[model samples]
Target chain A: MNHFIIKNRKDVQKLSTLAIFAGKTMLSNGAETYRVEDTINRICSSKENIKEVDSFVTQSGFFLTLEYEGEIFTYLKRVKDVGINLNKINLVNDFSRQFVNQDISLEKGMKTLDEINNIPGYPKYLKILGGSYVSGFFSLMYGGSPQDFLPSFIASFISLIILDKLSKFNLTFFIDRFIGAFLSSLLAIFAVKLGIGVNLDKIIIGSIMYLVPGVSITNSIRDTMSGDSLSGLSKGIEAILSALAIAFGVGIVLNLKSKGWI
Target chain B: MSVLLQFMYSFFATIGFAIYFGAPVNSIIPSGISGGASWSLYYIMFSILNDKILATFMGAFLVGTLGEALAIKYKKPATVFITPGIVPLVPGAGMYYTMSYLVGRNFNKAINAGTEVFFMAAAIAMGIIVSTIFTRTIRRFKRQN
Candidate 1:
């Protein structure tokens, strides 16, 4: 086994660093933990001298081990602010597949990996427009009158801006969702109070739809069914926590209304 | 007319969601189609049969199937499309109702709404799983052949 270990210390160091980069990209971009682990394994296995690789990832961080030349190296990486960006996930997936398929040099691979990690996230205007579109259409689909469309769009747009601004504070996701949903509900209620919207409830619901963690919930289900139990459970908890946050925000408003406090 | 309205809204909504999630630009339309088709299927099945569970199940299955095909064609994973594509079917209204009723201290209504959300979510998940198995099996068979 040692005879086949042609990779020297420098090569092993490069491999470990490359693996860490890929792992960070995947974990930070909200890839399933098992997928992160799988990608790391694939990237490392591309090197002939890499003997064994094992990785464990959660929503928070990862512990990875690599063995080569009869020596084992371990690394721990912290993951934070895991947001969903499918484009990054796809590019990294493609890169990892390319890495495993052939003789891409370590330097070239690192450059590609850096590019994948640095690809710009969604544009600012796009986030606001996307938020408006989702809320507006969702309101209509949920049986809101045509009168509610513009109000829903406006409410969601404002909340999106607020949400983006709050994100810069590096607050936890719960606070982000809570504040965003609260603002959405408040504005929607104001629209209704002005006699412009027919269904206050529908508008509120539609606007707060932006706060729902649909992606996390859907991915958790897929992850669980795919047999990655811990990853599934962690993502499931994330989705549930976000849901609770949204409900908290909306509940404060509705509870006030029910009590004639507002 | 109502069905068409629902379809169009879901289509654009899914596209918007895809953008927000930063999905690949070229696959956005396909994801939109998946969302539109899922809503249309659910509407048809629901109108004809008055069955929410079966309707959502079939709808999610169609969305998953479409996502799986689009994933293969686009060289991306099925999840990229599926997550955004199924946004239209996530029982948003049910969740809202549950929250409102709970807030209002209407326990019975809250329970009703909550159960509906639970069932709908489960149906959607089951549908996706079933369709994933279908696609995986077909791909495996195709490779073997």
Candidate 2:
């Protein structure tokens, strides 16, 4: 592949914008901070005559600067709606690698990125089925009897549907997780009372497993290990708060049960 | 028998989570393998050592190493595998119990569970870090040779 040449200030600006756009896509889709920084630097530096590129990425946003022909350009983007979509991250990762290795034009690159951004996640029914599988199997793993499986599945299925509907309201992640957990626990208790579930604790744990901050904990540790302490700290706090939210949701139900209120 | 059952359960559970997290379809089985293997390892270690934190550390390390290997083989980022693989080992039960004890006004048990939860999380982090360092050192050694 021929080397992409940097011809003018416009080219440099376009390159920087492309790099930032790629980074934003990755970051919003749950790539680690250091990986985003690396992708931005790699893409920016891929072209000839680009003298330098530096990128600073965090969990929330990123800043990138590029130098070409004694001129410096900077792009700062504040990313919102940070959701876990590993497919998008994978696509963007492949896109960046192709951009660096092949002589892809700036316009084509932007178009490809836009396409990646527009790709929808798995179908909603499949995701709900996945949710039920997770909760059902988790309860079994937690030592729930065979009878507990159906109840756990039913509880998580309803709660996941509710959570999916709740997403449209644009509520904070905390409230979303809190309500998910609360609803699941309430359903679990009802299932046990109805003799559908044999173990309340196991069912509750399984249902709430969907709300646990698994991605945040993994990403925070990874970011920290790779020396991105700022992103790591923030993500760690996010993990803790989300866990607390889940706990609070469950605890309320348990307290009510003990008080004979539910 | 129980261990095998746990393995199968975790495998499917992890696959479910992998799908929910939008992992690529081609990568789902590998992530499930990593998750199931790590959880079984944790179960065995926990049974032998009777220590939750240490067992979790062992589990996380296995997941990290396996994830890195799978990432290299599949040419995808390690997080794709590691994220789903580590979820089963996360101390969700600990978090729940701690809050339950606190709500019950049992400060002593709450502190106990809370401290264990904190250390288990730290152990998971340390395990992943150590595995990463180990993999990096191996790569460096290969490069030097």
Each prediction's total of clashing residue pairs, residues at least 3 apart in sequence or on different chains, is 0, 0
Model 1 segments more than 4 A misplaced: A1-6
Per-residue lDDT of candidate 1, residues B70-130 (tens digit)? 8889899788889888888887788878988887779999999898888988898899989
The segments of candidate 2 whose C-alpha lies over 4 angstroms from its true place after superposition are none
lDDT of 1 at A41: 85
**TM-scores for the candidates:** 0.95, 0.98
Q: Report the error of model 1 at residue B80, Å.
A: 1.0
Tens digits of per-residue lDDT for model 1 on A101-126? 75677778899999888888788799
The residue pairs found clashing in candidate 1 are: none
- Model 1 chain A: weakest 10-residue lDDT segment is A1-10
Interface root-mean-square deviation (Å) of every model? 1.3, 1.0
Q: Is the docking of candidate 1 incorrect, acceptable, medium or high quality?
A: medium
* Residue-level lDDT for A77 in candidate 2: 93
